[model samples]
Target: MSILNSFLIKTSSVKKICISFFASQFTLLIMMLYTFPIINSQIGTRAFDLQNLGYSLSTANQIVNNLNNQTTELYLFPQLTLLDVFYPFLLALFLSSLLFRLGKLIGKDNKITSLLLYLPLLAMAFDYFENICIILMISKSIEISKSFVLLSSTFTVLKSLLTTFSWIVILIYTIKWVRLKIMKKATKSSLSQS
Candidate 1:
């Protein structure tokens, strides 16, 4: 926890935050515009990771079964190894940095804020675990356990919830920060006029 707090505080600069935000956006654009479409078209449905509401074991089996040679190849290589790997990490960094900065601006940089900053990181970790479960499911040698499927679905649900909650927190802090800046400006203007 101390390590995480130190890392967050160290990386919460405007420059790092902006870079991570744009990089995450660019990666998402690539996934949405290119990778996801191809994979979905090949599989004839949304990928497991995209199933924000989570998937049942039967649905998971169905999706895995639908993976043709090309789709499986794509999913294993670029989808899981490259795009998904980077997207979660970059997004977590951006969100965590932004939240830390916003908390500082609003003068709420305390224990609660520190804990809230963990949301994105937790989401990212869950996403990685979900991907590992997916890889295991995709492998021919490995017997797909009902437990693994359940765990994957659980991780997916958690990732979605944490990510959503983090964004909501960021939005709330952003509104407060904007209001604070405006009030400061208004006070300055009144003093200048007087």
Candidate 2:
């Protein structure tokens, strides 16, 4: 909590920090996109295909059983779930700040603004839980527990929903910000001409 408070204090009014976070997200996206295909090729349909099969012990076991020995041994490398935790963590901070800034641009009421500012934390929190669960499942390999798979799947669903909601809100606020900027510029130009 103190760390969160400190981060909020440090980043609250710093537009550059928020922008940097977005930039990092873009880079992360590219890296993940590139690596996922490579991992998919090596592991075949094990990772993502099983991920789509819903959250269950059966699904988890299937995924675990499908793992190649080499992939299982080299688990943390190239596809580092431990280090990947930072992506969603930083995303929650930067995205919330961006949404809050955008909300204010269109004169959103304080209640709405406050919700926008804090809501991304839900996504981030779930993402961390999901990561932990995935790591556990991976470490266990063929012996992965059904309970862990169920837990990870639940967290994945939650993280997906919250992340989608956060992005939707950000999109709405961004559109509002753009419209407001255009309107304000038009109003100023008219005044100058008169």
Candidate 3:
């Protein structure tokens, strides 16, 4: 295999696969580099909030509200294309990859695989809730109020750090186990040939 292929194999575990699926879910918690130069330049020239933008803040914060006011601004990103639309789904995919690794270690059987696949889907639903809160925070549709800035920044940073740590520790070990199994299978074949 080439370098990239080898890299992918080393990282490929059922858990990692599931995490990748979940991480792509951003529709609920949509914010970008929140401070990226691209964002600053793009959303920077203007600001908006639900009220001025002609939307109501969720009282029950129901799923219907989430769907109704997915975007805080009417003209937020005329240039923003389909990739932006699927970004959340893609993010959920990435996060779900980790669950695949978790399942492998817990049990790589058919039962475990089924469970792993479903776990991330559940997580995606929860993430949508978080996104709802984020949508409510865009002040003047410009910047979020301090509370939301703190909520999202703190929640996202902590979640990311935990995810990274889990991948480094658990996923690395799981990958090693898989390699060992493959090597063992190879060894058995060689012995039978002899």
The TM-scores, one per candidate, come to 0.93, 0.77, 0.42
Best by TM-score: 1
Where model 1 places Cα greater than 4 Å from the true spot, the runs are: none
**Could you give candidate 3's per-residue lDDT for residues 1-194 as a string of tens digits?**
34423443444575565554554544323544342223334443322222112222232223222322234342234213332345534553554445444445545535535444444344344334334444455423334445554454443334344444444544655676788789889999999999
If both were scored by TM-score, which would come out higher, candidate 1 or candidate 2? 1
For candidate 1, the lDDT comes to: 0.89
What's the lDDT for candidate 2? 0.66
Q: Residue pairs in steric clash, candidate 2?
A: none
What's the CA error at residue 46 for candidate 2, in Å? 6.4
Residue lDDT tens for model 2, 22-71: 76677477546755555556655545322533467775666566667677
What lDDT tens digits, residue by residue, belong to model 1 across residues 76-112? 8888899899999999999999998999999997899
- Against the hidden true structure, what lDDT does model 3 obtain? 0.42
List all candidate RMSDs to the true structure.
1.6, 3.6, 11.7
- Those runs of model 2 whose alpha carbons end farther than 4 Å from true positions after fitting are 1-9, 12-19, 26-34, 46-54, 141-147
Error of 3 at 116 (Å): 7.5
Worst-scoring 10-residue span by lDDT in model 2:
45-54
Candidate ranking under TM-score, highest first, comes to: 1, 2, 3
